[model samples]
Target chain A: MPDVCKAPAAADALLEEERFQALSSGEAKIVEAAASRIFPTTDTPGAAEAGVVHYIDRTLKEIYPKQIASYREGCAALERNAKETFGRQFTELAPDQQDKILSAFEKGTASGLADASEFFALLRKHTMEGMFCEPMYGGNRGLVGWRLVGFPGQQFGYEDPYINRVVDLEPIAHEMPFSQQEALDGRKS
Target chain B: MAARADVVLVGIGAVGGILASELTAAGLKVVGLERGESPPYSDYALKDAVHAIVRHALHDSARHEPIARRDKEGENTRRRPVSSPTNQVGGALNRWTGQSNRFAPGDFKVFTQEIASGLAERAGASLEGYNVADWPIGYDDLEPYYTKYEYEMGITGADGENPFAGPRSKRFPMPPLRDTAKFVLFRDACRNLGYHPYRTPNGILSQRYKPPMPYAQGIPERPGCVYCGHCNNYGCHVHAKASTLYTHVPAALDSGNLDLRTRCKVFRINTSPDGKVTGVSYFDPAGTVQEQRASVVILGGYLYENVRLLLLSRSEASVHASGLGNTHGLVGQHIMAHEDVRVSGIFDDQIINGFIGPGSVGGRIDDFNSNNFDHTKLGFIRGATIGTSGSGTPIERYNIVPRGMPRWGADYKKYLTRYYTRSFDLNMQPETLPHKDNYVDLHPTECDAWGIPLPRVTFSLHENEQRMHRFLAGEGEKIMQATGAAKVWSAFSKRGSRWAGGTRMGTDPSNSVVNDKCQVHGIDNLFVMGASVFPTMAGYPPTATVAALTYRAADFIRSQNALFH
Candidate 1:
């Protein structure tokens, strides 16, 4: 298996074939804004910092048709709402202001922005899903979320534990977060 | 040109795949026809996970098509735009959770003893409205086949451990999977509450199998399961879960007697003037009508398609005007879907790695399932099995909160994050018996891409099933409460009737679609495979039993040799 934990360069070729670079500038900004809010850089790295926004944009272009359409609609609506309320685009809003806008939408307390609330909610849902779903999508940052939950990465058979006693399983990493692509490629060769 | 075959198998899946291998090995020529593409081993790699799991590449996207339902007035009703799209070739086996369980020995005979007896006493009630009957073959006749299925499918469980199960001659091929965090908590809690929790039987292989002899012939070297957190309703990337594609399909191909045609939508099974099957007409991928002749035919498609094929084949002036093999007008009559209910509980100190395991590897309490419990006084003839497992992903789990909790903000965040680690859930699989009124028929309003009327399922939960659902929920609540769960949220059975019945089985040709051998009555050369033939679904997953029945039916077809003439 190719190392998914490597820095984005070695897999960068594969990522290109996957069309991860196809996101327009506007689309990328919207996705970056959305991912950051859903998984802010609070306790850990936010989605944008972890490359999750890029991953989500790639997935929307590659995997799900339904998700792509919904995302496009949400992006348009969020911008319109931001322009109407704050005389600015959503991507240009201050961090605190962005948080307030998202919070109101999530809580359905947005004044004159009820429709935008649902749209933002949809954006939030998809961003978080893309950021933390299976690492096959280039998210989860080296399976960090899985590790945090103490999930043993792909071990065969738990009978050893179930039949014996409560076995505190060791966590496994399939690839490093970002520095192993060449090592994996060289090994395969 | 007519393609001749000693035996022609349709729907190269669990049952058909096994049958092809067996019949070809028995010195017979077999041609297996499949509607799905051949899935190579590499297609199940981690890279393919996105395509297979997220996109659901193999599933029927045709589920959104409009379909009509039959109501109580004997009229076709407009549907709310629904379609039953299963997997293509291996059918739903591709996306199943691999929970293999057998129906109780009594399940096969419920039509005669319970349904028949009830009709005799009830006013204006008769088996006339319903075609429910007993299976022609009994458990004793199928025990060997069940064992064979267990070995071939690499089933895992402690044999004879389930108190309610029938006596088996041998144990499971492999021991059960390790318990997930949720299962550990549930098992410990059940133990504290004085309930025995045994390992549930599943089709997932825990350890590598080295057959004493050559295991099912031509099978590829399969790796043991890697617990890749992608087993529920998703095909296993490692082929450790022994679906038909992994175990039997390749074996059949190795014999060189099987030929599969992808995207071949079967239109009808054509018959000669003498009432003997001549061949089947189907629309190939390029939209050409092609007829293939066969000495014997097997309709091993899943439940809905199997019945729909027969219904489409029926001609006017035929004795079975209702449908093919409906000489007794019982074809597509008794259709049963399982009743499912779920309950969630919150804990103050537990954060299970819910997303780290397959959907079926958990603590399943089957003591209350099927005829296992005393239901004579409860007014319900059947019961259900209660179980709990972890299938929530992180983003999804963040949204799962106790009812009435703040949807967002500091308070909501605090409560969700605190309980997210300690939250657990329990789900119930209850039996839905065949009712005369519940059936699958051609929708009067909707059509598929091929202009064939979609199968509209009209079904509802019976009063008995409702009561059983409540009973199972009550038991689960008690279990959850006893486990120190701070808060438990549960619901009674929803009133919407999606559970279908009718088209049941029995020895009598007058009431069932197929005989004990799963051969269609009157249509001696045709067989219908899948849950459609099930007399009544037991209160558990049906795929395992469906695979077992396929194996048994294939064996019956081989032994009879009624086709080679």
Candidate 2:
């Protein structure tokens, strides 16, 4: 098995086709651009660096198939707005120009296709989910989101000694998911 | 063909799970019908945010069987695609936050006290439209069963710590769990504000506990809570959270007297010509129709489903034309839900570590709960329990930003990074009075996958509850300011549906579906359990009370076993 933490390039190459399972290549690019604008990479890694597009892609395919229509229509509208405003696709626009278009989407001012505000809200919610959710869901790569927000993920217990004390501790991400089944199974026997 | 049992229990959740254990122990074979699958211990092992939060893995998917809702009675109810109560074997208990609290003395006698004190008249809110009535049984009646439930379920708490709590027969099964820094801060803040702060009682275990007597043998010994910060909205992987799935259900199964049929959705209760329930008709997992005949039928389903089942069973040809136990057209009336008001503050000076404990592991002040405070002067009759909880997971905390902060983009990210560990929410779980209009009824147009009409909830916050909310929000703001926070803000002002009442219990057969013993009036063998039997929604969480009532019902059934024949 490939090391998911170390081999970013290999993992990216393998899941390339799976990333566009619901969306076309063009649509995928639009989502990627939109996600970056929602949680852009500033001094730290935002949604784009956290593999939010991959997360949304996989979720649309496996978890939320019903949202595909909204995403498609939303992306189409976003593209229309981008072209109508800046004479460019959303993916090709400058960061500042992209921000302006996203602002319009946020305010429900951008018009052209299907429900612009609804689609913007969906993307924003999914972007956040991808950023902070456990890394097992294909986003929050290397637990960057956890580190950035100072969250210690899946720490099983904090006893009396550490309970009433406030300590500024660094974020430590668990390699394996906290298994309810394993804990329960171990006790059942 | 129909399967036969001594009792048929619908919806094996908090109440049903307890009933199954108690009745099976009393030598009555029970057949429990659960609409969802019996999730294995392994299923509890993972607390994936995507599955638990995003997809709502534990709860029944609204997409499969949506619940319709409308604020007004005349308005067309639309399908609410999210938020249905849980349906699995353990039911909502599987994913409950486990904030177990006993209803205060005043909770049972609110309506009576209101009439005596003349607060209802003074506030210009008459009891005319509001069907709020005093419970036939008081706190003393359920005290022993409350003690029994606590010890049986291994609830950890500093008993009698909340001076405002009703008299208790015994201490909590275990001592309170260790407090976090955030709770300590909140407790100190409460003290500074001249309020009594105590450990919030919860069903989650504080330490490894072996249950006593009959329940001990079959149930696995549960370890102490690890403070995984995934208690609410997530099942316990470590068997630390005392869900019915891990407690009562296992004991029932161990007795070899319970036939738990998972994925069997009971659509209708069958009754004989003499106004007696025969059993129930349900759709099995494979969509095959099946029947379970029993001497006694217990509807232990959630509050919404209980009302829906009764309304659905009503037909012009049936004995219960109005509905089961609807002699006065009262089966689905007087529904109530708690309105949660939240006040949050961001502390820039200290790291509060908001994600450190189990769901109910926090410091709470019951000084404002029930009628403990001077509600005579206040506009509202009842008040809320002000508490500070540390159940905020990473995803939930991400959304908590200071006022005027943009919801998304770079500034929002910065806000989360700065305040996620520093902010703490002070919540008020306020008591909501039951109204004649707020209720659950069968939707005319919409139906579930089984072609059964969906339950439509018609609920709106009454003026009484609205006043109570505003007062509680103001109190919360005071507490937040007392904490010396850099910034404080009220996050929750709107009332969301918490869902209670419908098939409520009382002394009168004319108004209530069930009697004090939870037996459906005029139908001796028919019963309803859970919060559905609660006439009013108390400020406290209802699961522990639901369990106690179930135990009480089981005891009543065992005593009246001769009538089963």
TM-score of each: 0.81, 0.93
User: Best-fitting candidate, measured by lDDT?
Assistant: 2
Q: Which candidate number would show the highest DockQ if scored against the true structure?
A: 2
Candidate 1, lDDT over the whole model: 0.64
- lDDT by residue (tens digit), candidate 2, B393-487: 66877766667888877788777877777878887788888887888888888888789898888888877887888888888899988887889
Tens digits of per-residue lDDT, candidate 1, A1-189, equal: 223222233222333444444466676676667567665544433454346666676556544445666666666666766777788988898876777767766776665554666766666655555544556556655554443334444454344433212226664434332223222211111
Error of 2 at B255 (Å): 1.2
Tell me the docking grade of candidate 1: incorrect
The TM-score of chain B in candidate 1 is 0.89
The ten-residue window of minimal lDDT in model 2 chain B covers B55-64
What is the C-alpha DockQ of each candidate?
Answer: 0.14, 0.37
Pairs that collide, model 2? A179-B45, A180-B44, A180-B45, A180-B46, A181-B42, A181-B45
Interface CA RMSD, all predictions: 7.5, 5.5
TM-score of chain A of each: 0.62, 0.77
**B-chain TM-score, every candidate?**
0.89, 0.97
Error of 1 at B247 (Å): 1.6
Native contacts present in each candidate (fraction): 0.12, 0.53
